[model samples]
Target: MAAAARASARARPLAHPNPGVAALLVKDGCVIARGWTQEGGRPHAEAVALAGLGDGGAEGATLYVTLEPCAHQSARGPACTDLVIAAGPARVVIGQLDPDPRTAGEGAERIRRAGIAVTVLDDANARASLSGYFTRAEFSRPHVTLKLAMSLDGCIAMADGSSQWITGEAARAHVHAQRARHDAILVGGATWRADKPRLDVRLDGLEARSPVRVLLSRGVAPDGVRVINRPSQIGDLEGVQYLYVEGGAVAAASFLAEDLVDELHIYRAPILIGEGRRGLADIGLTNLADAHGRWRASEQRQLGSDTFSAYLRSR
Candidate 1:
């Protein structure tokens, strides 16, 4: 399941409307075939893995899939559950159940009816890899990730608002890579006016994967930029399963205040600006106790000279 989850990461926002699933066929404790969801959501992971089998095939092999094989057939592709049944796997281990109403539990039921054993597991890695799909399936909006770069003293810039590079090149490259994984990237109106950032992926060979540019403001956006009046209107963003918010103070605070941010990424630099611009504005918090249990740290690492920390909402 962990290997399948790692494979799923390669097809993330690219799969959009479909869950970025992965499948592994193992026989005699050796992985024989592996596959992940292809681009544009065609040829699901199970089908791809099944196709990769050689002479031995899937008979008597155990299939590990990150999500339940889809039972409902689509005009674009065949039902994955049917394919798995035909492959004659001894057992299917599913990391998570399908959330789509069309095949919520139907896929598992069909597989079991075919005389194949099915085991469902609550896997953390698989769930994290499918966060975008789960968020979109349950809520209408995308999974929101708010990213901020600050100094050791928790300031975003000097008091004059002349902020340039806070973290080193490695962190900036990492941010661009993250931008490529999201369907859209947004910045507040104030930040847009101040920095005029490109807000696009700059890494070599990934320039084409730059996310849709979004402006969080009521005012008119420049040519080719999408606009949302407020953070609550994130649901209106069509086809966006993942939304990355790169910010100034006001916009970051707005999303945090509304409790809309599902994940938080913090990049901390080594320097300190004593009396400088803050990383966030008022988030409408009355009691400090309310903030204690809302976020759980998931990862922390050093990127060049800066420290990067990631947290997930504990809901």
Candidate 2:
């Protein structure tokens, strides 16, 4: 389980819209093969690790996987259960059972019925790594995270809407990293018209994975943009496992009103823009007390001249 967990960390930033998973094949207490889910969701962890084993692969080896092996068929490939069964690992250690309706506990049952030992380790690390995927599956919607960068006074932009560079380069880079972990990145129609931003990951050595650009406009979006007029419209997106809502005030309020937000990321610059745009528009939160326990702080960090904080919705 530890080896599987360690391998899973590498899949973190690339696993949006799909669960990050890792696998390792060990024989005689010596590590022999390891693999993680590659970008574009192909060459799954189990397939990669099993392929590395060659002929002697699973005869006397133990397979450690971050999630239960998949049992359903898809256009992309065959079921992982079939692969594991063919390889015939001596034992299997799984971090968590898959929650997708097609697999659920069937993957584990198939493995155990095949005369292989199966062990499940329910721990904090596994839960944290697969949180977004699990949350989306259980809730039947993308795990939503609202991201905002604002002044200490809670203003997002100036009165004239001349907002530029609220946080330093380091903070902006950090925001891009966050974008890489989500399937879609959204912004208000106003922000879309004003900034004309390109929501693509720009980290070096990391192939640019552009989050599907979502505009919160009721009408048709620009020449080459994706727009969602209603919150329910997100259902049309095929494999959107995670959704990042980065916005101006109006767009933030829209999602909040629909009770669609699942997490919040706020970057507070150490300055103030008093009478300008607020971080959030009126989402009909009756009072500060009404919003008290909706979110729990999950992370906090300082990036150059900015303070970045992340809050997860309390379930």
TM-score of 2: 0.88
Q: Model 1: per-residue lDDT, tens digit, 103-219? A: 998999999999999999978888888998889888888999999999999999999998888889999999999999999999999999999999999999999889999999989
Reference-based TM-score, model 1: 0.98
Give the whole-model CA lDDT for all candidates, comma-separated: 0.93, 0.83
In the predicted model 1, the residue pairs found to clash are: none
Native-to-model Cα distance after best TM-score fit, residue 37 in candidate 1, in Å: 0.9
Clashing pairs in 2: none
- Cα displacement (angstroms), candidate 1, residue 229, comes to 0.3
Winning candidate number (lDDT) = 1
In model 1, the runs with Cα more than 4 Å from the true position are none
